[model samples]
Target: MKNYLNSTMIKITLMIVLCMSAFAFNDSKVSAKDEAIDLRAKAAILIDADSGKILYEKNANKAYGIASMSKMMTEYILLDKIKAGEISWDDQYNVSKYAYKISHDTELSNVALREDGVYSVKELYEAMAIYSANAATIALTEVMAGSEKNFLPLMNKKAEELGLKNYTFYNATGLNNKQLKGMQPKGTPEDGENEMPAKYVAKLAYQLVKEHPDMLETASINKKAFAKGTDDEIMMTNWNYMVKGGIYEYKGVDGLKTGSTDFAGQCVTITAKQGDLRVIAVVMDAKEENGDSTYKARFDAAKTLLDYGFNNFKMQEVMPAGYTFKNNKTIAVKDGQKKEVAIEASKAISFIANKNTTYKPKLVLDKKEITAPVKKGTVVGHVEIQGDGYGYIMPVKDQATVVTTDDVQSKGWFVKALGGIGDFFANVGHSIF
Candidate 1:
C-alpha cells in the first residue's frame, strides 16, 4: 500500500509541474512589430489598455458629436447597475406612456416596445447593446427604475466614478437634445453642428471595456432576431456591418457599440485584443469626405490603432530575484520541510515603443539569497529590468516551500524568531483580497 500511494503522489505532482512549466514557457515567447496602416478621421484615438499608451491619434484630443457611441455609456451604466445588484438580468418592466412616446417621436433607433406584457432586462440589454435599439433602451430606463430623468443622474455619478473628466449623459439613447432653456453651452462651442456628445460617450464606452470586458461576447455579436413569445417580441439587426461580415483580422475581436445619425455622421467604440494587449478605438462625427462610406473612415482609423498596438508591442518575463530566467537553485528550507516555492514579481512589468524608437530589455534582481518557511511565491527581495525607453523591477520570493524551521539555511536563528513579522502583514493583504 505505501508503494502504491507513493507512486500516485509522484504522478500527480509531475502532472502539476508539467502544467506550470507550459504556462511559464509560454510567457517568455511574446513578441511583435508594428506595420503601417491607413486612417481617415478628423479626431480619433487607438489606446493601449494596459499601459494607457496612445498608439495612434488624429486630433485625438479633439471632441465632436458621436451618435450611437453614447449608447455604450448607457449600456455601461446599466451594466454597473446589474453588477452592483441594483438590478437583475431577469428584472421585468413596463414601458410607460412617456418612454413609449419618446421612442416613437423620431427616426432614432428603437426596439419598439408594446404594452402587451412585461419584458425582462436581459432582452432589453440585448436590444441596446447588441442591436443599438434606441427605443428598447428608453423602455428599459422607463420600466427598470422609473424614468430617464432618474437614470441620467445615475449615469453622471458613474461617470465621476470612472474618472471621466469630460463626459456627460443627456439621454438613454444619446440623441442630440436641445438643452432645456437654461443650461449653458456645456462649454461646447456653438458651431451649429449640433455639438454631439462624442468624448463623454467614448469615455463611457471605454469604461465598459476597462471595467467589464466579458460583455464583449455580447457586444461583438452581429445580429439576431426574436420570435413572438407571450412576454415580448421584436426583431433586430447589428448596425455595424463591419462587425457582422467585414474582414477585421484582430484576434479576440469582441464587441462595443456603433452609431450614426445624419447629423452625428459616424461614431464607434471598437474593442479587440492580441495576446495580453486589448485596445479601444473611438471616432466621432467624421467628415466622410475622405471616402464614400462614413464607416470606411471609422474602420480605417480603427484598423490603424489595432495594427499599431499588435505589431509594435511585446510582453517579457522578468525572473524573480535569487532565481534565473532558465531556473533557480534548489533553495534552502526550514526544519527539513523543503518544498518548491516560486519567487514573486515586485510589480507588473511592461515596456512600450512607437515609430520613433527601437528597444532591448535587461533584467536586474536585487538579492541573491533567500530565507524560509518560504512559501511558494513568497517575496523576499527584488529584480530590476531596463529597456531602451523604460526600466522595471522583479521582486524576489521564497523559493523551496518552507515550514517551522530548524534548518539554518532556510531560516537563521535571528530570522526564524524575528524576520517574519513584515511578511505576516503582507500576507494579510494578499489573503484578504
Candidate 2:
C-alpha cells in the first residue's frame, strides 16, 4: 500500500508540472504578441522618407479630423505660387475682417493681426508654420486664391494631385466652421472641419518636403517674434514641441506639423533623420492610457513610431547592380549573333528591413526570350523583394528594373536562311525515321 501511494503521488506531481508548463508556454505567446509597439493613436503610419516605402501602419486609411495640420496644404499652395512667380514672399496682405476677428480669439493660436495691419507673406507664413496662426493662414489663402472660399478648391485639387484619396478640406485654417462665425467657406456645414487619413497626412508631409524642402527652414524655428520691434509685435512659439530646444526635444527631430481640437484630439506629424535614414511618422488622435487626449500623448505616439523605425530597421543593399538571377542567368535571343544573352539588375536595390528578417528577391521577366539586336541596357524584367510587410507608398509595384548585360546583334541573312534549312531537314529526317 505504501508503494502504491508513492506511485500515485509521483503521478500527481507530473500532472502539476505538465499543467504549469502549458501555462508558461501560453504566457510566452501572449508576451510575444504584446511586444509589438503600440502607437497609442486612433491612426498612425511610419514610412521611409527617401524611398516612400511604408514600414508600419495601423488604421492608416481611415479619415479623422485634422486641425491645424491643414496649414501644411496651405503652405504648399503658397510655396507653389511663390515658385511660379505668381506671388512673392515680400508681397503684403491687408488683413480682412475675418482674419482680424479670428486673430483676436484667444481660444485659437494666432499672432493677433491688426485690422489695418499690412503683413508680409513671409511674416504670415512664419506665423502659420511656426505658431499655427489661424488668422495668418486665412490671410495667406486670400493672397493665393483671392479668398478662402476660392482656396478650398485648390486645396482639394492639390490633395487629388498628390494621390491622396481620403481627404476633405472645409477651410484653409482647419478650424471648425462654427468657429468661423458665419464667415466659413461657402457650402460647408457649420460643424465641418478638415479631415484626412494618416496615410494622406504622411503623403502630404512627404510632398511638402519633396517639393518645397525650404519649408523646413521656417518650420524648424522654435520661436520668432511676429513684426519684431514694432508695437504690433507678438512673440510666436512653434507648437511642434519636438523641435530642438522645446520640451520633449528629440534629437534629429525637425520641421513638421502638430494639431489638436475638441473633435480632432491631439495629433502630430514628425520627420527625423539619423545617419542616412530619414523617417516620417504621423499619429492622429492620440489618447493616453486612460483614453484621455493630452498634448504629450501625440508626441509620445510619434516617438514610439520613430523609435521602432530607427531601432528595428536599417537600410541595406538587398541586391547589387549587375546581380544575376540563379535560375535565369541568361535569356534566349532569337536570330542573334549569340543564342543567349546574360541579364542583370539595372540598378542596385536597397530597402529598409528588420534586422532579424531575411528578405528574398524574385526576378519577374517581361519576356523569357527576345528577338535580335538587343541593346546592352535594354530592360527585360524587374526584381521584386518579398517578405516585407509593406510596400512603396505610391500606388505602383515595388520593383527594380533588370537589363541586358551586353548587346546582341542580329545574325546575317545567309546564316538565318541556313539555320532555317537545317531545321527543315532535321524535321524531315525525324519523319522518315
Candidate 3:
C-alpha cells in the first residue's frame, strides 16, 4: 500500500508542475508582445495630446521641482483673464520695485524690468515666455490679482479645476520657495517650492495647448524683441533649445518651456505635432554631465523621448466613420421578421500603436440576439481591435435601418387579427384620455 501511495503522489506532483510550466510559458509570450520605453530623467512621461493617454513613463509620479515650467500655468491663467476681458494684450502694467530688484539679482532668470517701467501685457508676456523671465512673470502676476499674495488662491483654484492632484504652487514665477517667502500674503503660510509629478506636468501641458492652441504662437517664436530696436529692447531668445534653429532642434518641434535650478536640476516640457497628432513630453531632473554649464542633459532626454514616440508609434485607423462591416457581420435577432441583422462600426476610431503591427477587429454585442423592432441607428455592440500591442473598444456600427423583417408579415391571420384588435383599443384609449 505504501509503494502504491508514493507512486500516486509523484504522478499528482508531476501534473501540477506541468500546468504551472504551461502557464508561465503563456505569460512570457504575452509579455514579449508588449512594447516599452526607457528614459534617463529622474521623472518623465510621453503622452498623446488628444486622448491624454500615457504612452510611456519612468518615475512619472515622483514629484520633482519643476522650476520655470510652472510658468505654463501662469500663462494659461493669464490667457484666460485676457479672454474674459479682464485684461488685454494692449493693457499696460507698471513694474514694481520688487520686480526690478529680482530682475537684477543676477541669481535668478530675468528680463531686467526697470522699476516704474510700464509694458503692455503682450510685451511682458513675450519676455516671460521667451526668456523665462522671473521678474516679468511676477509683474504680470501682481497685475492680474492685485498682488502676488492674492494670486495664489486663484492659481490653486485653477489647478484644482484642471484636475491637478500632485502639485502645489508657491508663487507664479516658479521661483525657489525661499525667494517667495516674503511675497506670501499674511495669514497664508508658505507651501514651499512648486513641485509636480512628471505625469501631471504632461497632463497640464496637454490641457494648456488643447484649451488655448494659440499659445503655441507665442511658444514657437524662438526670438522676439522686448522693446524692439530701442537700447532697452533686449533681444530675448527662448530658452527651449529644442525649437526651430535651437541646438537640439527637431523637425516640427515648437514652443514650450525649459526650467532648471539647484533643486530642480534641469527640466523641460515639450509639445510637437505631425499631421493631426500631437505629442507632449515632460522630463525632470535629468542627470547632468560633469562640469556641464549648459544643462544639456534635459534637452538630450527630451529629444530621446520625442524620437521614441515619433519613431516607434504610428496612428492606425481601426475603423473609419460610416464603415459598414457587412461581411459576416449579421447579428442574430429574436422574434424578428429577419433571422439576423447586419451591423457595422458606429464611428471612426484610430489608435497609436507600433509601426509594423496589424490589428484585427472583434465585435462584442451587448446581447447575443438583438430583439426585433431595432431602429436604424441603434447601438447594439462595440468593436474591439486586437493586435499592434494595443487594444481599444469603440461603438459598433449597424445597418442604416432594421425592423421586423417581412418573414413575420405572413404570421397566422389569427395573430394579425389580434394585433389589429389591440391597435384599435389602444387608439380608443388614447382618444378618451
Candidate 4:
C-alpha cells in the first residue's frame, strides 16, 4: 500500500487510462467491436475492483429502476451499524404486520416472516441477502431506525455520502409503491421507487465489499433454514445463479445479490476473484426473451461480461522487481558511501491489463534528488503504466529500499552541515540541468 495521489487526481488519472478494443462476446466467438454482445440491458458495467478501471459499459450512467439490487446499500448500512456497535447480531426483533404481509403475500419473494415470530438481526440479514427476503429487509429496517420511514433518511444520506449521483433510495427493499399494494407511505420520497445507474451500483458494491469485507460471510451463503428449530422453519436458497451449484453457476462466483421487477426487469451485481485480481460486474434491466422473461438473460449477460474479463485480461505488475522504469536514472546522494544512488521503484505495483496489448510504462519522480539521511523505503517517485485498450494507470511508488547507494560515515556536525548545504544546491542544479 502506498500514498499514490489525491482522490480526485487518482480518479482523473484512472479515467484517462483506457483503450477501447472493438470486441464483444457472443456465444464462443469473439466478435468485432461493432458486433458487441446484444446484452439487451438498459445499463451495465464491468470493472476492476482494485483499480477502479472500467472494462466495459453500456449506458452505465443512465438511471433506471434498480429493483432489489438496491439492497446492497441496505446491507452496507446494516453492517455499518453493527460494526459501529449500535446494534448486535444477537439482538432480536419481532416481525411486524407489514413484514408478515409482504412475506406471506406469495406475489413477492420472502422467507415467510410471521408476525408472531421473533428473529435475530443475523437471521434476517441472511434471508435478505441470500433469499432476497422482502419481509426480512423491512423488519431489519424497522429495528434499525424504529420504522421504515425513519430508516429512509439514513439510506438517502448514505447515498449522498457515497457520491452516488445517479442513485435514489425510496424503500428498504427496493420496491415501488405499486409493488407494495399502497402500503408505501404517501407523499414521502422514500415511498416511491428506487433508481440508480448500473455503474454506480457497481461502484457501490465494490465499495461495500472493500470496506465491510465480512459482509460476504453472509452474502456468500447459498442455502440456509430460517426460524431454525421452530415449526415455522423454512428453507432459503440464493437467487444468484452465479453462485456454486446454481443452474447457471459460473466458476469463481461468490457472494452477491440479484433483482427483478416489472420496471427494473432483471439485474445482478457480482464479484469474483482469480488469484490476485478481483472484479465486479453489473447487469441491469435485462430484457425478457420471447416474453418468457426469466432470470437467464441477466445471468447470461453477467456471465458474458465476466467471461470477457477473465479470458482476455491478465493482472500484471506495473513495475515489478528486477525491472526499471524507462525514465529512472541515478541521482547524486550527498554524504553517502557511493557518489550516487540509483533511483528505483520503492513499492510493488500490479493492475489488470489487456492480454492483447503490450505495456510500456513511464516513470515520473516527485523530485529528481534527495538529501542524505534519507531513510530506507522512502517514496521518491511513481511508475505510470501507459494505457491501452483496457489499460489502467497505476502509480507504483519508488521505494527508498530499492535505492542501492549506501551512506558513508559523516565528518563532524559542522562539516556534514556545510557539505549538505553545498550539495543541496548542487543537487537542485543537477535536477534542473
Best by TM-score: 2
lDDT of 3 by residue, 1-433 (tens): 9999999999999999999999997655321034554456788887767767566777777788998999999999999999899999999888787777777876777777767688889988988888998888888888899887788888889888877767878778777756653654444446567888987788788878888889888898888888776667777788998888777788777868899877787889989887776889898988754535346888888888888778877676766755555564667765556667666677666767556555566666677776665666667667666653411111123212222222321335676588789999999999999
Please provide, for model 4 over 167-246, each residue's C-alpha lDDT reduced to its tens digit, 9 standing for 90 to 100. 76768888777766666744555347789988788878878988898777777777899888888888888999788877
What lDDT would each prediction earn against the true structure? 0.57, 0.88, 0.75, 0.76
User: Candidates' TM-scores?
Assistant: 0.61, 0.86, 0.77, 0.74
In lDDT terms, how accurate is model 2?
0.88
Model 1 C-alpha lDDT versus the unseen true structure: 0.57
lDDT of 4: 0.76
Clash-forming residue pairs, model 3: 219-255, 337-405, 344-397, 345-397, 346-396, 346-397
Query: Listing every candidate in turn, what is its Cα RMSD in Å to the true structure after a full C-alpha superposition?
Result: 17.2, 5.4, 7.8, 12.3
Cα lDDT tens digits for candidate 2, 102-195? 9999989989888889989999999999999999999999999889999989998999899997788899988899898899988999899889
Give stretches of model 1 more than 4 Å off.
1-37, 178-203, 227-234, 244-251, 287-293, 316-348, 352-356, 359-433
Question: How displaced is residue 375 in candidate 4, in Å?
Answer: 11
Displacement of residue 65 (Cα, Å) in model 2 is 1.0
lDDT of 1 by residue, 256-364 (tens): 7777766666777777776777766776655455454466666666666666667765553333223333454334344323443444344444344443443332333
Ranking by lDDT: 2, 4, 3, 1
lDDT of 3: 0.75
